[model samples]
Target chain A: MIAAVLLSLWIGSSTSSIAELRHALFSPDERVSDIAIREIRWPRTVTALAAGAALGMAGTLIQGHTRNPIAEPGLLGINQGAALAIVSVAVFSGPLQPWPQALLALGGALAASLIVFGIGRVDGRGASPITLVLVGAAVTALCAGVVSAIVLLSEAALETLRFWQVGSVVQGYDSFLALWPLLLAGTGLAMANARGLNALTLGEDSARALGITAPRARGIGLAAIVMLSGLAVTLAGPIAFLGLLVPHVARRIFGADYRWVIPGSAVCGALLLVVADVLGRMLARPGELPVGVVVAMLGAPFFIYVARRRKPVTV
Target chain B: MSARRTAPTALLLFLATLAVLCLHLSIGGTPIPLPDVVGSLLGISPDPRTELAIMEFRLPRSLAALCAGVGFGVAGALTQTVARNPLASPDILGVTNGAALGAVALLALTSQVQGLPMFLHAYGLPIAATLGGLLVSALVFSLVWHSSLESNRLVLVGLGMSGLCAALTSWMLTLGDVYNAQQALTWMAGTVNGVSWADLAIAPLVIAIGVALAAALRNQREVLALDSDTSRALGMDLGRDRIIMLGLATALAVAATVIAGPLAFVALASGHASRLIARSTVPPVAHSALVGAIFVLLADLAAARLFSVVLPAGVATAVIGAPYLIYLVIRQTRVRSA
Candidate 1:
């Protein structure tokens, strides 16, 4: 991850040498490459790492709780929810500062998840995984519909959304300052839920037999997911498939233990995003593709592969 | 469920569609009287402004809605029938996003590449959209196919593909300038706003032929709804018929998407709406088409007239249809568990 961050700093629309990186770090000169490294690329690298780690951890927690291989924050309408809130604020009022925008996004994500969970919950228990996913899709469509309606109606809103909706990390460190504590809290919650998540993975009833309060464990798991994913979306604009992709990779490497999976996912997610950001810088040249778009390009095929491989359920 | 019983329901729906059409044509930001709209339709000039409003703007937009709605309706019915899943539709199955991706990519490219041939701009959009929808549908079908398509698996796989296509579409949006991105975004929301007669040239004809073809294949649609073994036992070639029907559905959906951006839920709701209204065991294609037309016309009317700002018809459909979908899913789960 550190190496990937260095690589991201080194490559940009204007290439910089390794000597320049050393100079930026040790000497702290005002050379163009040094300034570019400090001013533009460094903050972007931080944003990518923090946001990517948040998303990865979120994915691990949610998949662990749900035990559904294909589930992710985006799939469950959390990302769209954040997007809708941010876009609504932008449309109604002018663009918000990074702090307020992140807050609103977190609020929106919470509301949307609650709605999905509320409607999808059957009495005391959750709906079947497929039902919940379908409900989430419906909610996503609804939110997306409203967001686009607002965007299409106002040119200003369209301009704001066009950049933000695609998930860019170009905005720099203001978001990171506001976001890190929340990200830390979410990570802490995720880590704390690890043993509970492992128990839940053995099935809710079994988890109960193991003295884990199934609903409380699920709630904490969900809370962690919402916080982590919401901050990531606010920070990086709703990068799809990251949450879905990372946990699987984490599980492959770290086995089913949530203790390992949680940390593994965070590290892997940071690594993936840092690498993707570097690639995005390289691919578009000068303008640069958004890290979200780059990740989508990388992660969507994996999503399809997982979908294809999962055993088809009998109707 | 009988054809005889469905006749009056169909007629009622057709009349409702015409009423909605007239309502759509008569009212806008500048409201023209019904008499003026009627007079303009009859080739009588109700003054040049009214004439332009009716003949140039409203007519094409209304007709586009009508045609696209019909296409979505039929396509939705066909998809549902083929998959044996009421929840399966073009939008949900990634077909609409696929079409949107194609159209948006072309729109972005035309703006980015500079000095593209005029013919590509004029004719390329529908072709690109159709090809994209077909390609995604093929991918979804192939991914899910292992001896047979389980309805649940098809939807899940389709959802996965939809996410991928949506990401690509967003990427395409970023490739273009702000103006182009705005245009693509509006279109992606399934608006018929600013649709000129020229923009709608191919959609009407294609929809007409597709609907006619669907009506002709009514018997096959019915047979294909049965279990594969039963369908084969009845001397039907299940594989060939399924492909032809699915292909036809894709074509219809693509044609509709070309006219208006993938109008969400018109297809999904149309099938179920028509089925309920007609009290049919299966969604009747003709009735579904009429219902779909009504759905779009009403949605457009609500979008354009009801809002302080004109929103896309797709927004209205989604806002309305998504809840209905939730209801259906809830009902289905209840029934299943019971």
Candidate 2:
């Protein structure tokens, strides 16, 4: 992870000398490279780390709670919900301050997930993986339809949406600073929920026998996922496939233990995003490709590979 | 249910598609009388101005919607039959995304490059989109074909490929002029608003061939719906039949996409809608095609007339389709749980 962060900080459209970077790092110099490094590169690198880690942890929680290997925060309609809310608010009442934007996003994400869960559930039992995913797809389509309608209706909304539609780490540090607490809270919640997730994985009845209280555990886990994903979307827009693939990578590396998987996903997710961001910067040259684009391209083949290897009916 | 039971449903759907097509033709900017519209469609000129409006403007748009709908329906029926999964469609299987990426890349490229030839500018997109859809379908089929194509694996592989294609298309959006981006957005939303006779030159012929191919595969489709082992036990060549069906479906999807820019849910919903109405085991190809045509025509009508600002037909279809999808899922859940 450190190596990945260093690589992101060092590489760009233009590279700075090592001595200059070192001098800038220590003395807060006023050179162009220093300013770029401090203002643009540093925040972007940190934002990437924070958002990636949050999404990775969120993905782990979602997959664990849903017991669906294919589940991701994005697949749960959280990203679309947050996007719809942000776009609607922006169109109706101008751009908001970062705090309100984040709050609205969190509200949107929570509402969307709740809707998916509510509609997906049959009887009192939680939805099957296929049902959850299908419902998620429907909700996502619905949100996207409305969003496109609003975007088409207003030029101001269209301009705002064009940038927000693609996930990028090219956000101001202020936004990151404003939302970092929620990330920390979400991470802490995820860590706390890990053991319960492990217990619940055995089965709800077995988890109940173990005194794990499946509903409470799922509730906490769901909250963490929504918080992490919502805030991550706020900081970096919606990064596709990052949340979906991170937990699988973590499980492959750290085994099925939730305690290990949670932290492993965070580190791996951070490393992957930073590397993808660096690659995006390098590949596109003068204008960088969005990190979301790069990650989706990179993650898709892995997704296909996973799908091929897994059994058809179950994880 | 057999053909006898479904024939009436098919006939009704056919009449409905024609009625919707007429309504689509007559209700645009200037409302032409039904007699005049019918006359224009039958090669009789009501007058020069009305004839121009009907023959030149509305006819092409209506034909684009009809042909595109037929293509999507045939493709959807073939795919769903082969996959044996109710949810499978060319849209879900990455063909739409691939085609959209291809078309958008061409438009963005042409917009950036100065003094491109008019021929390439005008005709490049459909060919590019068709090639793109075919290439991605080939990639998807190749990836999933380990001896025989498995149903869930095919859908999952397609989903992954579509994700990649969608990402590339979005990145392409940032390439050139913002005006070009808006144009790409409108097209990607699946509008038939600006389709002209020239834009649709290849659509009718390709769609006809697609329908023929689908008809040829009707027997195989029924057998393919059974378990692969069962079908193979009954002397059906699972691998060969799946390849043919998927290939035919991909071609039809490409044809439709080139005309209407991936109309969102026609392919996904048409098969199910037809089966629901016809009470058939498999979505009958002819009935599904008629249902698909009516779906797009009605969607286009709503898109053109119901909105304060004209939106793409794809938007209306999605709005209609998503809820229907949710309802389907819920019903499936109920049946399974019950």
Candidate 3:
């Protein structure tokens, strides 16, 4: 992941040699290459790293707690909820900085999760994973519908929204920086709860026998997920499937243990997103595809493949 | 699933449609008095202004909404019956996104270094959209058609595909210049704004044929909800009928998108609404169509008048429809559990 991030930082529209990259890193001077590396490439790479890692962790926590392999922030409507909140600020409130916007986003994500979970659990047996997904899809569509309405009604909102609506790691150095502390706190919380989560995965009855209070552990897991997902979404709009794909990849590499899966997910997601971003930069020369779009283009096929090859998804 | 259509329910729906259609025709960016609207319709209005508004603007727009609504409503009903799932509307099933993506892809390809070739540009969107929708239906049908179709997997996979297509559309927009992006985005937002006589031309013909095709296959289409052996015993070829039903549904939805830019919820809401109004588990095709038309017309009316700015009609429908979808989901879950 570190190598991938470093590689992304060096290569973009204007390629800088390793020597130039080293010079930019160590003996930074007022050179065009140095400035590009310092200002443009570095921040973009870091933003992707932070957002990707957070999303990957959030997916891990969400899937772990939900006991649903397909669960992710986007599929759970968490990201849309956060984005809707930020967009609402852009539309209704005067204007907010990145810090305040992200705070608003966290609140929004929490609200959406409650609604989604509430709707899902209405089934009486608790909402099945499939049910949660279906309800989440509906909620995401609804939020997106409302967001579009807000954008259409206000010019000021549109200017900010059109770009954000499509998730990207375009230009948000401050926002990304704002997320760093929360990301650390959330990651720490997730890692701390990992051992309990692994036990909880044995089902609530077994988890209770193992002396893990299932509900309390699940609550911690949800909070961590909300923090990671909300902040990531606020930093970059909503990068679809990052959370869903990464945990699976992580588990493939490191096994189902939450301790290994969490960090592994962070590594895999950051690497994947950074590479996707770089590839996106290369794909459209003067212009660029959003990293989110590239991820979807790649992830959608993978999603189908997984859905097809696996056991029929159930509760 | 079929039940007797109650007279009072039919009368209620009929009156609602008539009243809304009248309201739709009589009002616009500027409201014309009811007398002037009727006078213009009868060619007896003294004012040329009233005639122009009625003929050139208001009439075409309202007609487009009604026809498109009916098309979407019928399509929604067909799809729901075929899938045996009320949630399987064109929009939810990714047909709308597929059509929109196909149309936008065509637009982008043609408009790329130079604008679209005039012939393709002028006549291309509906064709592209319909073909796109058909393609998606084929893919969706094949994916879920494991000896027998599984509606659950179909909806799940369809939702995934819809999101994927939307992402692809967004990518295409990003690659295109700003003006094209704006145009495509507005279309995807789904609106009947600026619909004209030209826009309404192909829809009526296509819808008429599609509805006739659906009616002809109505018995076989309903047999879809039956198990394959029973349907076979009943002289229905499950595969052939399913394809024909899906094809017709896709065409109707494509027709709706052709006029309304993939308007949301009408397909889903109208089907469910019509089913309730007709008091049948089988959504009555005619009732669904009528209810759909009334729904869109009313939604458009709210969008145009209820807002300080004219909002897209799709947004209004979604605002009303999505919650209803959630409610339906909750209710369905409850029923199943019970």
lDDT of 1 by residue, B1-338 (tens): 57789998888888888878888999987888888887888889669989988888789989988998999999999998888888888888889889988988888788889789999888888888988999999998888766347457678778878777877876677667634533764556788888888887788888889889988998888887888778889888877888888898899999898888877888888988888888876689889999899889988888888768877788899988998888878877787777
- Model 2 chain B weakest 10-residue run by lDDT: B178-187
What is the docking quality class of candidate 2?
Answer: medium
TM-score of chain B of each: 0.95, 0.92, 0.93
Per-residue CA lDDT of candidate 1, range A1-315, in tens? 678888988898888888998899789877888889888888888888888899999988877776677778877888789878878888878767777888888998998888887777753455677787888889988998888778767666676666565444455367777678898899999999999988887777899999999879878888899999898888788677888889888888998788998999999998998898888777766677777778887887887777676563211
Regions more than 4 Å wrong, model 2: A123-125, A166-172, A311-315, B105-124, B146-150, B175-179, B226-230
The reply for model 3, stretches above 4 Å from the true place, is: A15-19, A160-171, A313-315, B1-8, B113-118, B178-182
Residue A5 accuracy (lDDT) in model 3:
75
On residues B61-142, what C-alpha lDDT tens digit does candidate 3 reach at each position? 8888898898999999998988888888888888988998888887777767585468887888788888888888788778
Better of 2 and 3 by TM-score: 3
Query: Over all chains combined, what TM-score does candidate 2 have?
Result: 0.92
Q: For every model shown, what is its TM-score relative to the native structure? A: 0.94, 0.92, 0.95
What's the residue-level lDDT of B164 in candidate 1? 77
Task: For model 1, report the TM-score of its A chain.
Answer: 0.92
Candidate 2's residue-wise lDDT over B1-338, tens digit each? Answer: 67788888888888888888989899988799998999888888679899999988899989998998898988888888887766778987789889988887887788789998898787888888888899999888787677336455676677788778888887777675533533675556788887888887887898898898787777888898888889889998888888888888998998898888877778889988887888877888998899889888888888778867878888888888888888877887787788
- Comparing 1 with 3 on lDDT, the higher-scoring candidate is 1
Q: What interface RMSD does each of the candidate structures achieve?
A: 2.2, 2.4, 1.9
